[model samples]
Target: MPVFSGIWVALVTPFNEGAIDFPALRRLARHLLDAGVSGLVACGTTGEAAALSKDEQLAVLDALLDEVPGDQLVMGVAGNNLTEVLAFQREVQRRPIAGVLVPAPYYIRPSQDGLLAWFGAIADASTVPVILYDIPYRTGVRLELDTLRQLARHPRVVAIKDCGGNPETTLALIADGELDVLTGEDGQIFNTLCMGGRGAIAASAHIHPQEFVRMADCIANGELAAARVIFQKLQPLIRLAFAEPNPAPVKSLLAMQGLIVDELRLPMQRSSPTLLQRLRAELA
Candidate 1:
C-alpha cells in the first residue's frame, strides 16, 4: 500500500482579518505531522474550500506544499464545477501536490449517472490521480456503490474518501475489489477496517492523530483489545468535533492550544460557548 494509507486529516484552514493565516496553518500542520498523521488534506469541506477564491486556494496549497514534508501525502480538495475544476487541475499541474480530493456537485445534486460523467471527465483531465470524496451530508448527493465501481474502472481515479456512514456500502465496494475505501467518518473507521476497508481520511485526526493512527495500526496488526481501548477514548472528542459545522469545533480546540486564531470565514462561525466549555471538559 502507498504511504497514503492510514489516517489523513482534512485540515482546517486558519484565518485572521480575512486573509489566510500562514503562521497558524504552518504550526498546525507541524503538530499534525508530529502526531503521526499519514497525510494532510488542504481545502476539503472542513477546510472551507468553497469559501476560498481560486488564487487563495492555490496560495493555501502552495504554503502547505512548502511547510509540510515532501514525504507526506498533500491532497487538495477539488470541488464540483467542471470548468473551474479543469482550470484548477491545469493550474496545479506544475505544483507539488500528491493527489486531488473531489466530491459530487452540492446544489445541483446530480444523478448517479451524472456524477459518473462529472468525475470521469475530471479524471481524464487530471494529471494526478483523483480520490473520490463521498460525503452526502455535505454534498446532497451520494455516489452509489454501483456508480463508484464503474468509476473505479477509470485509471486515474484511485481511492475513495467515504463518509457515506454505511459499512454495507463500504463492504460492497470492498467486494468489488477495485477501489480502496478510506473512511471519512471517524466513528466508522474500526468497523470499516474490520469489513476490509483500507483506512481513514478523518477530520478528527486533526487533534488526536497519534491515538487514531494507533487504533488503526492496532487493528491492522490484529491487536483488537488495544484498538478498542483507544477507540473508546476517541469517541468523546470525535462527537464534539462534529457536534457543529466542521472545523468550527476543531478550530476552537486548536485556538485553545494557541495554534491558530480560531477565526472562521463568514457562514462558518466559531463554536458556541456551550460547545467550547464541553470541548475543554471533554479534553480534560
Candidate 2:
C-alpha cells in the first residue's frame, strides 16, 4: 500500500567486482527504510534488472524480503518473453510482495492490441496487484491512453509507474482516477503530485529518501509551499542522478557514503571522475 501511494525508492542493486552483493544489498535496503522511504522497488531499471539473470533477480528480491516487509516491497518483472515473464511472475508470487512492477515488452514494438493482450495475460495470472510500468524510452513501446484505460478496467491492474512523458496522458490518467498514477521520472515528481498523482517511484530519492517522504507528506497535507521548497532542494540531485546514466550517478553517491562498493555490471559503467566530483559537491 505504501508503494501504491507514497515515495518508493527505485533501489540500486549493489554489486561488488561484477557479482551481486547480497549483504550490501540488504544493508542498502535497510538504509533506505531507515531514511523513511515509503517502500522499496527491487530490480527496477535503476536496479539494472535487465543486466541480471532471472535467478539473480529473485535472489535480490529474497534478500530484500529478509530486510523489509512484503507490503513495503514491490518486485520488478521485465522481459520480452511472454512465457518466461509469466513463469518469473509465478516464481515471484511464491513470496508475499505488494505488487509486480511490469513494463511493456521491450525491444519488440507491439501495437495497442498487442500491448493489451500482453498486459491482459499478466494481469490475469497475477495474484497480487499489478503496477503497470509505462516507460517507453526504455521499453521501446508506448502504452497509449486508451490501452491504459482498458487495462485499468482489470481488477488486478491497480497502478502505473508513469514515465511515458506525455503530459496529456498523465493528466487524463489522473483525471480518470481509476489507477494510482505514480511518476517514475524524478523531475516530474512534484508536478505529478500536484496534479493529483498518488506519489513517485523516484531514483533520486535514493539519496535523501526522508526528504522525498516529507515532500510527499507535505503535498498530501495541503502544504504546497513547503513541498515546493523540498522539491527545489532535491532538484539538483535529481538532475545529476540522470546526468550520466541511472544508478551510476546514484550508486556513486551511495558509494561515497560507503553504503556499497563503487561498481556496476558490464554494459553499464561506473560514474566518471568529473561526475563523481560534481556528486560530491552536490552532496556537500
Candidate 3:
C-alpha cells in the first residue's frame, strides 16, 4: 500500500513580494509535521502551485527534502501539460519526493479516452507512484469511476485524492475496494472516514491540524459522537475558507497567526472585507 494514508495537509506555499517564502514555509511545514500530519503535499492547489515558477517549484521540493524527515510522506503536485508534466517528472527523478499527485489536464476538458491516455503516459514515465487527483470542479474534467478503476490497476498508480465532495462517490469508491479514497474536502472528513475511506488530504488542516487528527482518532476509536461535535464546529470555518477563492482565506488565517505575510500572486487576490471579517471572527 502507498504511505499516503491518514491526515496529509495540502500545504500552503508561503509567499512574500510575490515570491516563494522559504522561511515561512519551513516553519509551517515543521509546525504541521509536529502537530501530527502524516504527510505534506508541497505544491498542491492549496500551495498555489499554478502561480509558482518552474524554478521555484524545484526549489520548494529541494527545501522540503532538506527540511522534512524521511519518514514523513512528501508529494509534489505536478499536474500540467503533458510536456510540462513529463519535464517536471524528469526534473524530480533524483529528488527524495514520495510521489507525484496529478489531475487530468485542466482548462482543456479532454475526453475520457484522452484523460486515460494522458495519465497512462505520465504513469509510464514516473519514477515513483502517481496519485490521481479528481477534482472536476477545478479540472473541468472528471476522471470517472471506471477510468479510475482502470488507472488503479497500473503498478505505478496508487491512491486518489477525491475532491468530488459527494458521499455517494465516496461510498462507491470505498465499496469498490480496489482503490484507496482520501477525502479532499475538509467539511467531509468525519463523514468520509465514517464511510470507511482511508483519510483526507485536507487543506483546512493547515489551520486545525489537531481537529482533523481528532476526527480520525474518534472514528478509529469508534467515537462518532465526539467526532460529530468537532465536525460541526469546523464546518463554518470550512465554509469561510472556501467563501472566496482558496488560499485567500487560508493565507489570511495564517497571517493572523503571524506565520507568514498574506501575499498572493496575480489573478488571485485577498479575500473581500466581508469574508475577511468572518474569517477573523472564526480565528478569534
Candidate 4:
C-alpha cells in the first residue's frame, strides 16, 4: 500500500509582490514537516495551482523538491486536457515524487468510462503512485463509487483524496480497503480516521498541523479520548479557515504568525477585515 497515511498539509502557496515567495514557502514547508505532518502536498487547491501558470507550477514543484524530501512530497496534477496534462505529468515525474494527486477532468465532466480512461492513462504512464482526487464541487464531476473501485485495480493507483461528500461511498471505500482513503475535507478528518480511513490532505491542517498530526497518531494508537480532545479544539479554526474563499483566512493567520506575506494573486483576495478579526480572536 502507498504511504499516504496521517495528516498531510494541503499547503498554501505564499505570494509576495505578485511573485512566489520562495523564502516563506521554504520556511513554511520546514515548519510543517517539523510539526510531524505525514507529508506535504504541493500545488493542490489550497496552494492555488489553478491560478498559477504551468511554468509557475513547475517552479513551485522544483522549489518544494529542493525543500522537501522527494519521498515525502506529492504534487497536484490537474487538467481537463489529456495530452497537455500528460506532458505536464511527464515534467513533474521527472523529479522523484511520492505520488501525483489527480482529479477527474474539470469543466469537461467526463463520464465514468471517460474517467476510467483518463485516470488509467495517467496511472499507466506514471512511474510514481497516483492518488485520485475526487472533488466534484471543483471538478463538476463526481467520481462514482464503481468507477473508483475499478480504478483501484490499477497497480499505480494507490490512494484517493476523497471530497466526494457521499458518506455511503466514503464508507464503501473504507470497507473495500482497496485504496488508502484520505479525506480532503478537514472536518471529516476525525470521522474518517475513526471509521478506519487512513488520513487527510487537509487545507486547514496548514494552520495547526501538529494538532492534526497528534490527532491521527492518537487515533492510530487507540487513544480515542485524546484524539477527540484535539479535534474539538480545532473545530473553530477549521470552521473559520473556509469562512471566506480558502487561503485568504489561512494566509491571514499565517501572516499574523509572520510565516508568509499576506498576499494572494488577483481574484483570490485577502480575507475580510471582519473575518480577520474573528481569526485573531480565535488564534488569541
Q: Give candidate 3's whole-model lDDT.
A: 0.82
Answer with 1 or 3, whichever has the higher lDDT. 1
How do the residues 73-119 of candidate 1 rate in per-residue lDDT, one tens digit apiece?
A: 45565666788778877887668667888888788899998998899
What's the C-alpha lDDT at position 230 in model 1? Answer: 92
- Which rank order by lDDT, best down to worst? 2, 4, 1, 3
TM-scores, each model vs. reference: 0.95, 0.98, 0.95, 0.98
Candidate 2 has its poorest 10 consecutive residues by lDDT at 1-10
lDDT of each: 0.83, 0.93, 0.82, 0.93
Q: Write the per-residue lDDT of candidate 3 for residues 99-157, one digit (tens) a residue.
A: 78888888999988998999999999988878889999998888887788898888888
Which model is ahead, 1 or 4, in terms of lDDT?
4
Measured on C-alpha atoms, candidate 1 has an lDDT of 0.83
| Candidate 3 colliding pairs | none
> In model 1, how large is the Cα lDDT of residue 6?
81
Question: Of the pair 3 and 4, which is ahead by TM-score?
Answer: 4
Model 1 lDDT at residue 234: 91
Model 3: ten consecutive residues of lowest lDDT = 70-79
Name the lDDT of candidate 2. 0.93
